[model samples]
Structure formats: C-alpha cells, structure tokens
Target: MELKEITDHPSYPDAYWAAGDEVFQLMDPLDAKRTLRLRANLNHNLLLHRRLFLADTSILVSPSMFALLHDEELGPGYRQLFRDGSIVTAMRSAANNFSEVAALIIEKRNFVAEMEEDQIWASARLLDSLSPEIVRTDTRDEMLKIGHDYVLRAEYWAALGIPENVALAMTESVRRKREERNLDTVRQSEFWEYARDDLLTPGEAGTAQQIRAYMSIASLGTMAKGIGIPPIYPAAYGPNVDRIYGTHTPWEHRADRRMKLLEPFDQKDPRRLDEERNIHEIAALLTADQVSKIRDKVEHRKLLKGAQQAIQESGNSAAEILERALEEFRGYLEVGAGEFLVDWEGGGRRSLLWETKTGQLMRQFSSGAVGTAAMIPGVGPALGTALTLFGWRRAAKLEKWREGFREVTQEAINDPTIIPELRTDEVIELSLFGEIPYSFMALGGDAEEQD
Candidate 1:
C-alpha cells in the first residue's frame, strides 16, 4: 500500500485518508476552520502517537461544556475519574491546552444553537461554558478546544495496553476512511469521540439509549465492513436505540478490546494471550444466547485457549480467574464513576451486574464452562451494593437474592398496623411500603442477602 494509504496523506500523524472533506473539515479543533492537511495531521497524531498537537494556541476548553464541570478544578490539567473509581490524570502539555480550554467556556456558552440536530443543539447549550476570548499577547491558554483528543485517548489506550502507535494508526485509518456522524460512536471510541458526541446531545439517553451498540461497533472498521449493522434490536426488533445498544453491550467491550490490533508501544507485540484466554474461558461458561451475542464479533477467543489453559492449571477457582480477567477488561466498559465513591449501591450494582454477566458468559459459551465460574460469585444489587463483600459469599448472596427477588412481588394487601396515610419516606421507597422487613432496611443490609 502507498504511504498515503496507510498514513493519511500529508497529515504525518494521521493513520489513513478520509472519504469526505466536509466531515473532515468539521473535525477541525477550531470547529470553525480547518484544512484537509490539518485534519489528516490531527488524524495521524491520534492514530500513531495518539497525540493531539495544538499548533494554534487559539484552542480553548469551555467549562460549561463538560459533564464534571462542578467537580473539575480548572488547573493546568485534564483529568477524569475512571470506571473503577481510579483517577485519570493528565498534565497540561506545553501545547497551550487547558488554559485555552478554560477560556473557551465563555465563547461557547451560546454553542448549543450551533449544533446540527435539535437534540445536539440543546446539548451544546447545556454544557459547562468557558469565558473564551481572542488570543491577546502570548496567551497560551486563550481557550479553544483542540480539534483532536486522539493524543489523550491514545495515552489512555496504551496505558490500558494497546500499542500507542497502533491506536494512532487505527484512529487515523478509520477517520480518513470514514466519518463518525453520531453520538454512539463517540461513546465507544476515544475521549474526543465521546466529547464530540456529547457536545451534540443536551440530554443523554440515560441508561436506556436509542443506538444499536454492537452492530454499530462492528461496522466501525474491518469487523463490520460487510457484516452490516446487526439487527441489534432486542430479538432483532425494537425502536429504542438502547435495546439495540443493550444487545451490543456484552460483546461490544470484548470486541472493542479484542480488535486490539495496535502494535505494542515497544515494537514487540503486547498481545495479552492470558487475557484473551480468560475471556474465552469466561465466555465458555456463558449460555448459548450469550455466546451468540459475542461469538462471531470478538475474534480473539481462539487466541486465548493456551492462556486459559495456563490459568486453569494454576488451580485458581473459576471466580479467581474471572476476577483477574475483569481487572484487565474493566477499561473497555469505560463507564465513568467518581473516585472516593464509598457507596457501591450505584456503581456497586453496575459492577456486580458486570460480574454476573461474566458468570452467565461462562455458561453461555458451553455448559462445561458453566461450572467454571460457578465457584465464583453471583450478581445484582444485593451482593454488589456492599463495600466489604467479595469471594464466594458475595456471589452466593447475589444468587440467593436474585432467585428470591425474581419471584417476589408487592404483597396484595397493606398491613393494618402499617398505616398508609401516616407514613412518609424519610429514606427509600421502602417507606412507601410502610412496614418493611428488618433485613432489607439498611443500605448495608440491603446490599447483601441474609444467610
């Protein structure tokens, strides 16, 4: 292939050339102006080095534009809390980034009306705003959002283990060849993709969105090239994007990470065989339905058997194996939760749901693999809600609660002593029920199942 084929022409940093100029122009960090060459360069940096080089100090960040505006400190840095509650810390580059990010706040306050779609326009209006100004004197931080977050995202990808250059190249390749024109793509791609997508939607789809995640993801590059977007709709039928997105959820993370085609940062391949095996072995235990959800899309399963065998030979119980695998897999979900969040009730439930999914995942691949994670734990709010729980007990409790709750319903009649009129909820909806069981009463207790 020509250099231009692999590395987008002229943009030394970009990995591939794009199909359309209009979309590429829109990608400019300035949002208002860009050249085909600049777009390609930005694309190259994002894909190769995963770096976003700002030649123009005019870039600024609008505070009102961010989700964590209230939580973020406008220092010389860009940071975020991780999916697991860890902090994603980044220092301000000499490229005159964050200060400009700060100044962009004011300028973009009226940014909402600028979006193409009504939903997107409304969203831009809602974001935190930066008081932006024209660059005066050698102002490094005059505030203009860079046209690229590939660099930041590339660092994140490498830190997570994909090759830095590979990420850069892949990003450029897709960018040059295609144009991501929707919110869903951003959520799954890098930070910039997410930011750009987020900029267009004022009100998020909550947990239930309207995008078909798995199929959309599959279409991004090679995986979905001819596959066409899956009828991700539940049972391949639904108008809600979230249902389709939901269908994509399980395989999406694995597939995204599995497509870890990036060259290792050090030139040597950083293929995580052990990690790959863990996923397949884990998948083996999932049900056929679950396996079907991911089997075709995530190609790394075949590559994981050796590592899975090695891990299996270690005598670690299925749960132990899954835990280790999840530690490595966590970033793909890439859902942000704040650090120092002591309550698992929210994030905790989500985590448990993830684990339970693994367990089901184990069973989904093959019945033989089902028992593998059995020794692990169950899922749901009961087991996940706790701060101190782990091991078989946590799983056991989750299973018991799930089993019980599945069959539970509101009692037919209110108790005589539990007067409906006198009760007002000082706490949970449990108050609405008036008389509550002592066990489900406390958050600590509700977080787990009683023996």
Candidate 2:
C-alpha cells in the first residue's frame, strides 16, 4: 500500500493519467509509508472544474492536466499537450472506466428510473469484476451499490479520501440519491411500500417511496410535453388552419418535441414547472435498464404465463409469485398506476407490486399484455397504448386533447401516489398537467388529504 514500495502492477506502465507538471502527493500520516501518489490534472472549465481536479465530468468532456480519459460525466476523458490547448478527453482505458463509473453514479442518484439503474449497475459491476486488478485501490462498492439506492448509509460504507473533486463527486452522488428519493415522495402517495429486505438500498425508504416513483414516471409523458414548450391553442375553425397553433412556453416546446417521439400520446413537459424532468428522463432510461429486458419482446408474456401456471398448479399462495412479479409487469400494465402495498423485508409481507426483474417479467406474461400483442399484430400498439398512460384518454373529447392526455397519463404512472387507492378519473385529471393546467386537476382532489 506504500507509494514507493507498492510498484505499479506489471500489466500497466508506471505513467498514468496524471494532470500537472509534477506528481500529486497525499500525506497519509496514519499509514506506515504515510504517502499516496496519484496523477493530477487541471481543467480549463474553471467554473465547472474550479478545484483543479475532476469535479463533475460531462458526457462530452475530456481530461486535461494528465487526467483519466473518462467521459465528461466521469470527470475527464484524455489529454494531450498543445501548449495552451485544453484537453477534451483522456486515455481509452480511462474513458471506458469513467463511463462505467458515470453509469454507476447515475444508477443510485436517479432512483426512479429502475430499468437503466439495473443495466448501468450491472455494467459497472461487470467492469469492476472484469478489471479488478487495474485499479486495485479504487472504491467500487459505491458503484456496485448504485442501483440499490440507500447504500451510502450502509454500515460498511467507506470513503477512500480521494481528491477534493472526486470526493465531492462521490458526495454529490449520495446527495442526489436521497434528493431524487425525496423528489419521488414529493410527487406521489405517502404510504408507498419501501423496498423489502431482500430488495432495498441502505436508505430504509418505504412503500411511499415506490408509490411516488410510479406516479413520477406515469406523469412524465405530460411532463415531457409541458416542460419546454409554450401554451398551445387548438387549430380552431377560424382561418383555414394548416397546422394546429399553440403558444408553447419554452418548457412546452421541449415537451412537444419529446412527445413527437411517440405518436397518439399527450406530451407534457415538467421543465418550466421545475418538476425535475431531466431526472424523470434519466429515470425513465434507468427504468428501461432495470426491466427493459423483461419489457423486451422475448420474455414479457412468456414469463407471466409461467408464473400464473406455477401458482395455479403448485396450489401455493399466489402471493409469493404475484407479489414478486409486480416489478416487471407493473410497467407493462396499463392498470392506471400501482402502489407498494407491502414490503418483503423489514417484517412486512412481500409486495404484490413485484420489484424484481423476474417478478416483472412474470406479471407481463400473466397480465395478458404481451401474449395478446403476439397473438395479434395490430393489437400490440393499441394494447400498449391502452395499458400504458392513456388508460383514460379515449373518453376525453378533443382528438389532440385525448391523445395528448394519454401521453400525460402515462408519465404519471412512474410516479406513485402517497395516498391509498385513488379514482382513475382523478389521476387522469392530474395527467392533464400541461393541456388542462394543475388547477383543473387540483380542483377534484383535496390538497390537504394525505393517505
């Protein structure tokens, strides 16, 4: 562990992604060698990388002053000396490593996005396992614990005392974790089940957290629509209107563009409302990562049927199978929205909402969404549309409004509600965020009521 005595691993050259003219040194009085040596670098983005170290790397950033070749999100990519030239990237190995680390960081901070959270964490863990000896001293547990949020508070949690920027990066990683969690609660029902023992982060978060997460996502379609666009006006019967005209706010435009990605769905942007839409988007991607494979055409329905059959044939409590299957199937279900009724750990019964990928995959099969989609060609899109956020859009009046409302409804599903069962009508009304305004949705429900 001592600097001089601990020679570089034979696999790599002694020279590494260092930042400055001289090697950076850390005095560790506690250690017998009492010294730590690392490559240091300076970043020109003075405002962002003010600490003369890697604070936060954007996906597009590069490393300078001899830094790791990680992407902007990780810190830096690679650096080259061109006198006054500022470095934009780092070494290939560093870049790859940083990218993995970046994913790990995102996994935890953005808790609502379960899918990507799973994928990124899996990827990060894969990288760590594959390249264990590369950076033997590097702290990878944090990355490993990313998807399972709340691990920062775990008793084993330890900080490696890296550079200030790296330290802060790690710190913010945790801050963002809890912040996003709280953000989830802020948007939905309060009593949502916390992830169970076999299924939670170190944070001790409960069911309310999940409900909030579901609602947060289900609402995204509308939030996306409303976020960066201006208000819109229906193409009225005034002049021969070629295109529908709506005065979109900056947020509205953003939401509008995103919604255009999917047809026949309402787009509501959460940006202007400052509802943390970016987090929502990222969470959606992470959610994709978590259960995307289950959502994939291959397993969605097959597994669901298997689980149902298993429950029926075994004559066992369907609770075990159904409860666990909720995770994957929840997204596939157009059942409006779901809540964490109970937890599997912390002395509570397992949640029927199934938070695991296996469970989710089972739900998809049992729920009839995938099999039906496979059985009939055209029915896939229609089935998906109905089961997704648009569970109530058909009943609405206007064509644009109905489709748009559908978009809004879907986004809200990801974010769970704090209160117990809510009427679908109320949730739909809430989904009309951008199109109809909160006042309309707010009118039906009691603001003070908390279940």
Candidate 3:
C-alpha cells in the first residue's frame, strides 16, 4: 500500500508508515537482511527480543542507530543526529542535567545503576505487581535491568526520531496525536514531568516540534527493541570515567561494576524472559485502577477465581457473564480501577431489608470483597448454623442472601447518595501486600464443633 494510504490506528500515523516504506523500498534486500541479523555476540550489551526485533526489522532498518553509540562500530551515520536541529534542540531540552541523568541513561551505567532515585522507585512500584517478591530480596533485578534499558532507549529515540526524514514528514493528525499523547507521560519523576510541560507549553520556541521529532525517533527505537534489538550505549562513557582512566584506556573498574550489577540477570534464560513477557501481558489486561485497588495478590487471585465461578454458576453465557458481573458491581466498583471487593458479609434473605432500614449494618456489610462471599451462605442464624453443622450443605439456600446483597448493592451502585463516603473518583497506587491484615476467619461455634 502507498504511504498515504496507511493509517493503522490513531497512535500510528501515515508519515511513520511512509518512512518505513521508503527505507524498505530503497534498501538492497540482501544488505537489509544482513544488517538486521542479531549479532548478540558482538552486541552483548544490547537488549534483544526476537519478536520485537523481527517486527521492527520488517518495518525499518536496524544497525543504523544500533552502531551509532557502539564505540567499536562508530560510523558516519551516527553524525546525522548532530546535523538535525530538531533533534539537537529536543535532546538539549530533555537532558536538563547535560552531564548527569542524561549521560547515565545513554551510557552502560544504566545496566549498572539507576539514573534517578525517584524514577527507580516508581519503576519498582510499577513492577512489584508483575514480579512479586518471593523472598525479601526478590528485587526482580533482571526485570529492572530491562526496564532501565527501555527508558534509556526511549530517550535516544526522542533525540533522533529514528528515520529523521519520515518524522519530518508527519501528517497533521499524527502530529496532533503525538502532542496529546505526550501529556500522558508519567509525571511521577520531576525531570520528565517538567520536560513534557516545557515542550508542550505555548510560546516555547520549537519545543513541541523538537519533541515530535524525538517521538518519531523514539518510535523507531521502540520498534527495534520491541522485536529484540538491545538499547544503544553512548561511545563517550562520561568525562569522569575518562579522567580516572585516560580517554584511550579502558575503564576496567566501570566494566567490573557494570558486570557486578548485571550479574543477577541472565538474559539467556528463556523461562525468565517468558515470565517477564507474561508480566507485561497481565499488566496490560488489568487497568491501573484495578491493579491499585487489589489489596494483595492472594486475595485478588481468590476473588478473581470466585468471580469466574460465580459467573459460571449464574447460568449465564460466556459472552453475557462479563456484562452481568460488571452490572452487578457497577457502583460498588472502585473509581478509575473498576474494582469492587464484593461485600456480602451481611448477606441473608432479610439482611438487605435490615440494611435498608438500619444503614449502620449495611455500612458494615459493605466492607470486604464480594467475589467469594457472594457464594457463602449469608443466611439467617438457623440456616447459617445448620450449614456450619452440615459441611456438605449445598449453597443453593444462600440464593436469597445473594439476592438481598445484590439488591442493596445495586441501590448504592446506582445512586452514590446512598454511600457518599465510598463513592469517589480517586486513583491510588496498587498495593504491594494489599491483603487485609484483619479478617473474620471463623463464625463462632468452633468450640462446640471441636467438643
């Protein structure tokens, strides 16, 4: 298809596709194939994922930006960034420290240590859900290494807008979308937050244009790394390192430190890599609101399983289950995250009527998750006692309680006036150990049963 004819999604534009088209159209097929080869042995420091590499390779040229920062393979192509005013201005603006955070990002130092404390912690928090700490020290070193590499490469991409000519050729829609998307940039870190604001602010001289240029470069870099290519390392490994060990001389100390930090991660391990990929996949499926609302993995998993079972038991079709469950939890679901710990603690045939009359008891019942509780016998004292006595008792009798809880919950869900305190649109951070520390594990009568 012609470049202008390509408009895959709002995020991906015609100009970007056109650029890829041009690169492929002009290149010699054999040479292109050779350039795209994964030289892991030669580029050991780079991050390479086969799928991302293959996908990006099919779209554009590799080894161009890859070799730009590789000291050993420094070529004339690397100088092209300097010639581009848009890239230079954007990089200068983004790299506020000039010699600190910016330097570390593009250097091999990223694999060794974090560039900023705030950003690292933020990243760690974001990653905690995916790669949970099995042990006290299960810091997910490998995952963090890859994340740092990705962030650093994002910087380089922002600088060059890989395929400079194509970025320069962006359509109006693509350019406008880029500006809008830039606002979603995580503002947790001050540097990035300010950089985004400065670039986007009105009256800033070519800041937005420069950012768009960088975004174009960043997109190409993402495609490269998405498939399997590793992030690029700058040729000049900081002036401090050079001062300690002359410019021509090797920094064995720095190399040793980098090796020490990276020792925890083994990129060669396919299982670990797959696990990491799965983490991303899971994160994608869950919203930030949902992830944040989860109290703990144990509880979340239990609730999730219970929801699936509840949906299945409800006799609803697979297609209708999601809609039904969503309807059931509508107002009860936490804002932004769309999570609602189903509250059936006070569930019983009469509980809903009682809650409707005595708001205090209803408030108490509203606490705790609904998933598993929905199945529990939230019946009257006699039936609850009977179920406790007869362990094999079917949950069919609890349908009344389920209905009662649903009735009351539906009111609150539909009208926030019922429980104004619980209804809010705030978004909070996901819990590392969100499990409620306190729970009603038993319902009394245990002594009689033991006796």
Tell me the whole-model lDDT of each prediction, alpha carbons only.
Answer: 0.22, 0.23, 0.23
- Which residue runs of candidate 2 sit more than 4 Å off their true CA positions? 1-94, 98-127, 130-390, 396-451
Q: Per-residue lDDT of 335-395 in model 1, one digit per residue for the tens?
A: 2212312233333322332233522422221111111111012222221111100112122
TM-score of each: 0.18, 0.18, 0.18
Q: Comparing 2 and 3 by lDDT, which wins?
A: 3
**1-451, model 2: which lDDT tens digit per residue?**
1111112321100111112211111111222111011111111111111011111121112112112222232222222211111211121222245345555446434222222444544433433332222221221222233213322322212211122342244334545644756532221111112222222443322222222222222222122122211111111100000001110111111222222212342234212211212111112212212222223443345434544332242112322243234333333332211222122122123222223252231121111110000001111222112211111111233467545644553443322221111111110111111111011111112221111
Q: Candidate 1's C-alpha lDDT?
A: 0.22
Best by lDDT: 3
Q: Which ten residues in a row have the lowest lDDT in candidate 2?
A: 237-246
lDDT of 1 at 222: 17
Tell me the deviation in Å of residue 430 in model 3: 16
